[model samples]
Target: MLPLIPYALALPLLWATGPTAPDSLIIFNASRTYHYQAIFISPAGDTLSRERITMQPSGQPWVGQPKRQTACTIQYRYNPGDSLTFAARPNPQNQPGRQPQAYEWRKSTVTGVIENPQEIWMHPIRSNQYAYTEVAPFPQVRPADLHPGGSWQANRLFIMGGWGAFKGSVRPFYQVKAPATRRYGNQNLAGCWLIESVGQHSRLGNSYLDFYFHPRYGFTEMHYRFYDGTQISLVLEGLPTGNK
Candidate 1:
């Protein structure tokens, strides 16, 4: 058995560690539950849907420390009419920081396996549609890399062409604008930095853009506006609670 750490020593260490962004591009609190309120608008600027769901870590709640031979499967309980598992990785290893490396993100549907590398912070994270087997590099931003006046290029890899003629497609690179700090209710976001990133030349021009994050919560909110003037905003409705 391992020796137990004394309270005096452990307390300070815990304080020193504090809260940190996960190495993976996506900001997820593996241990906590998040409540998100989503408001969707239609093409003619009409309200479409309002959804509120609590994301609970349904399986393998904690991702083991990086660099080990572990089958890291981070699953979240999501209900979109049916039960779903949000992510999977047969093999996961510890990566440096959230800057240059990435892990895998997956979605399993009756059709086939849709896997994409979770690198830079970009999304629309290929849903469970069409058997797109080719793994693509979806690039964007890392939490540690976000700061005032800092910008990063978004270059995602994807498959293009017809249904049967699926060919590897490299989307055009675009820039993501990061705010130095976001002000809320006449004040700046305290305790953590708020960064919003958007894809400059996304397909719908506005869709698949405006990904937001907070260091403490990793993507506390996301604002998406489609080319047709439809607006959808997702915000964290409460504080995260978990085993930690």
Candidate 2:
């Protein structure tokens, strides 16, 4: 079951401002767009393909329905109505034999009141292969104080289907690690909060996600390890430039 803490008790701590406070660490700008490069890696550590991804705020309300009702509810920092749209296109120079055209564009809604918001719902805009709707909410209660070593668990209803279908639950146990620098392209991102999680899926087996959130850059990097031994890394490439 999802853990619950009264909102009245969490509000004061969530709004407190400081270098390590949750308010300062979790920042989102709804008006700005984010660009990233998605690198698909094989189980052998070879690069399989690359795609350019763009995420922009839609400024629209959440109107989609979940496959099952959520088990928990809590007030979110961002309006529940707000959503983000994500589109991905194959990089010009992708690996040969890789079908870049298989990539699909998605619209997703995120909800949570702490460091990282869980993607509760996802809809494909260009493809009819699969979708995800949260059947449960993430835990609202977190450490009273935010700092390295702080830990929490977030569980979501994992519902995916289309040509193939699977319905189950995924719970990722998250831990806050010390800030560090990571290299992306020609730039070195420093002072990024390293948040890591490990979880087991009913259909996908075991997996893990490493997320790096920058104080000023928001979500900068995400590394995913799937059960099948495939790894996908998404690195922020900054905002789109020029006419793009």
Q: Which candidate is the best by TM-score?
A: 2
Among all windows of 10 consecutive residues in model 2, the one with the lowest summed lDDT is 124-133
Candidate 1, 96-192: lDDT as tens digits: 2323212233332111111112222322322222112112222244444456655544434433332122233333323345444544333455444
Q: Each candidate: RMSD to true structure?
A: 14.5, 12.0
lDDT of 1: 0.36
Location of the lowest summed lDDT over 10 successive residues in candidate 1: 6-15
Total backbone clashes of model 2? 0
Q: For residue 53, give model 1's deviation from the true position in Å.
A: 3.3
For model 1, how many clashes?
Answer: 6
Give stretches of model 2 more than 4 Å off. 1-27, 65-145, 160-166, 183-188, 239-244
Backbone clashes, each candidate: 6, 0
| Best-matching candidate per lDDT | 2
lDDT of 2 by residue, 45-97 (tens): 87655655555533322222112111112111222121221123232222345
